[model samples]
Target: MNSNRVRAVLVAVTAVASVLGAPDQATAEPAARGGTQWKCGFYPTPGDPQGTTARYFHCAYNHIMIRVHWSNGASHLGCIEPWENHPFWRDGGNVVVNAYFVPVTPRVLIAPSGRRVCAASQPTG
Candidate 1:
């Protein structure tokens, strides 16, 4: 409980923190925009009169798999193969492979580095 002991403890903590190289999010630079962005598209299903049943999002990265969180409350840790367009879907949406049908597109997306993208180009229907 002495002044010297308190000083020594504070110094040790500072040293450990410096050695660990803790990052400060407030001062951290935002992640650069890159290929992790999703490209959404619609495809027709076989024997369907409407011809616009399939809906999906494709994302690709050159080096590593990127984890993304969709605005529709879906979090995915996929997109593995490098430079390949991996398909992802929104939560509670329907696909042609099944019986039920519910199509919805996410308007916002978040990446691992705290980078976010608002998909204004996506259809609002």
Candidate 2:
């Protein structure tokens, strides 16, 4: 897709996820065997030359889409490749950004507990 279109999609998905709120834990799909889990934290947005951090960050389990919510009542939908342990995509200024999937090595086995999505993101700066 064109850059503008892609950005619009991102913004729309993020907005929708934010408005809909967190997924039901009882309904959340079980984490796949050997799913890659990245350490949750505040990381730079895609294509950010200045390494601008988002309000919250976390990769989805397997290929399932996840909603990572922010403190300011915003959220974004993103997912990570279950097969890869390293960063998945690079910033082409549209689709993906620097270390967008797994900015660092996989550490935690599960996302932090919360009624909210990607709760209490730790700063990785």
Candidate 3:
């Protein structure tokens, strides 16, 4: 019985490790135009009473499209249509930016541009 238990535990540990260590699989090549993709989670703003952070996945090429999935059963679909018009892009020219969600806030900030940053803290009523 002890040997069986040990073997079961080893199998479980190996399965967990494999799942955590596996790399994301994407059909499109990373270098292909409009094919770059990143998956990241946003954290809640600091000092917020409610500890809720929005999670998002972003895909970009000519523009940025973010799918924000909130913990409160709500979601937001946003896009930086004029990403090139942003001052940060002025220097970089047409560029795709990656953004991570801030904790307790519903804001997304440009990872490179560092401009037009907005924070949406959990609503207090």
Candidate 4:
């Protein structure tokens, strides 16, 4: 290829890149602290969760679901309780929830259920 042709190709590539924003891992996800940074990418899949209404963010976590983590690698039945005090809100050692359950409720279940959160959601598990 001639010098001008090569230059033109390079310019086109740059233009395309500018049009499509680059991936930002740092701001995309949070880290464990002192540990390596969390991998970049959408932890949970995109799209609105079921039962999400125009008042979504205002009302979160309609139902109560508990996720138990076992040191020996086993799943436990959920514990029910008021928000914030529930075990489902926090993370445990050696085990982690498939996704972070976002439980927020201004009042009762008359509104939409809360959304389940994630880190970087890929097509395949």
Candidate 5:
């Protein structure tokens, strides 16, 4: 998609995320083979990038929490890293991403770690 379209999509995703900000533990999905599936805010959006440290997207549930840090670069798919919590791996300009609550099911497996998405995100217009 083009930059403008990507921006619009990102905005829409974040907008939809308003209602998904904090999911209830009662809504946690059933665990499968120990681990369950997780999702993003609909569309990927950039988190905070400044100061001495970098902020990331994260949530807490089932006594487990995950954090998705914004990548300086872009990839095709979201990510298949050691952990899949990243929700914002898109390339946007000055995006102020809001926070959301995270929940977990159960698991004892390791995922890949590195660049999240394989689809490179161009600068949003």
Candidate 6:
């Protein structure tokens, strides 16, 4: 191959390799420390004309739902609901839902129940 053609091929290969070599470059780390985790309960707040309004209770076990926010600017929602007898909600009564925001790609973890949602800043395991 001509010297110029070879150089061009080398450059192309190097570019491709660089891209393949760093798949995580575009994504952030997951579950990094210093991130914020919220543990709250979802319950109907009294006095609402609607009778019940879901509110964050600052406790997990009693929470009807849980959400996580990661320091990496990511968040994840629990897959279990407090009313659904989820393994996470076994202790029910005044339960505090635990959630942490992870710094990773695909930053959201929605519960299978579709009632909970979480988001992350990066990809996580």
Q: Which consecutive 10 residues in model 1 have the weakest lDDT in total?
A: 77-86
- Of 3 and 4, which scores higher on TM-score? 3
Q: What does the lDDT read for residue 12 in candidate 2?
A: 65
- How do these models rank on TM-score, best leading? 2, 5, 1, 3, 4, 6
If the candidates were sorted by their lDDT against the true structure, best first, what order would they fall in? 2, 1, 6, 5, 3, 4
Q: Candidate 3's residue-wise lDDT over 24-89, tens digit each?
A: 222233344254222323333333343322223333223343443323333333332222211111
Candidate 5 C-alpha lDDT tens digits along 6-122: 445644553443334433222343342145334443333233242212233223232223322234322121211122244443344433233333343222221132212212222
As a whole number from 0 to 100, the lDDT of residue 11 in candidate 6 is 42
Could you report the Cα RMSD, in angstroms, for every candidate shown?
19.6, 12.7, 19.7, 21.7, 14.7, 21.5
lDDT accuracy of residue 100 in candidate 5? 31
State, as a TM-score between 0 and 1, how close model 1 is to the true structure. Answer: 0.23
Provide TM-scores for the models: 0.23, 0.26, 0.22, 0.21, 0.23, 0.18
Residue lDDT tens for model 2, 40-114: 533435554545433233334433334443433333444432332222223343222223333443222233343
Q: Which stretches of candidate 1 lie over 4 Å from their true place?
A: 1-63, 93-125
TM-score, cand. 4 vs. native: 0.21
- lDDT, residue 107, model 4: 20
Residues 8-113, candidate 1, lDDT per residue (tens digit)? 5434643453345434222322233254332333233444343444333333322222333334333332222222222323224533332111244334334345
Which is the winner by lDDT between candidate 1 and candidate 2?
2
Best-matching candidate per lDDT? 2
Model 4 lDDT-worst window of ten: 51-60
Runs of candidate 2 with Cα error greater than 4 angstroms are: 22-125
User: How much RMSD separates candidate 1 from the native structure?
Assistant: 19.6
The most accurate candidate by TM-score is 2
Q: What local lDDT score does residue 105 receive in model 4, on the 0 to 100 scale?
A: 24
On residues 1-125, what C-alpha lDDT tens digit does candidate 6 reach at each position? 23243235434643453445423211222232136332234443445453332334232222222453323343344322222212222122332233432223233333333432223222223
Model 2 vs. true fold: TM:
0.26
lDDT of 4 by residue, 44-84 (tens): 22232532111101112233333333333544322122222
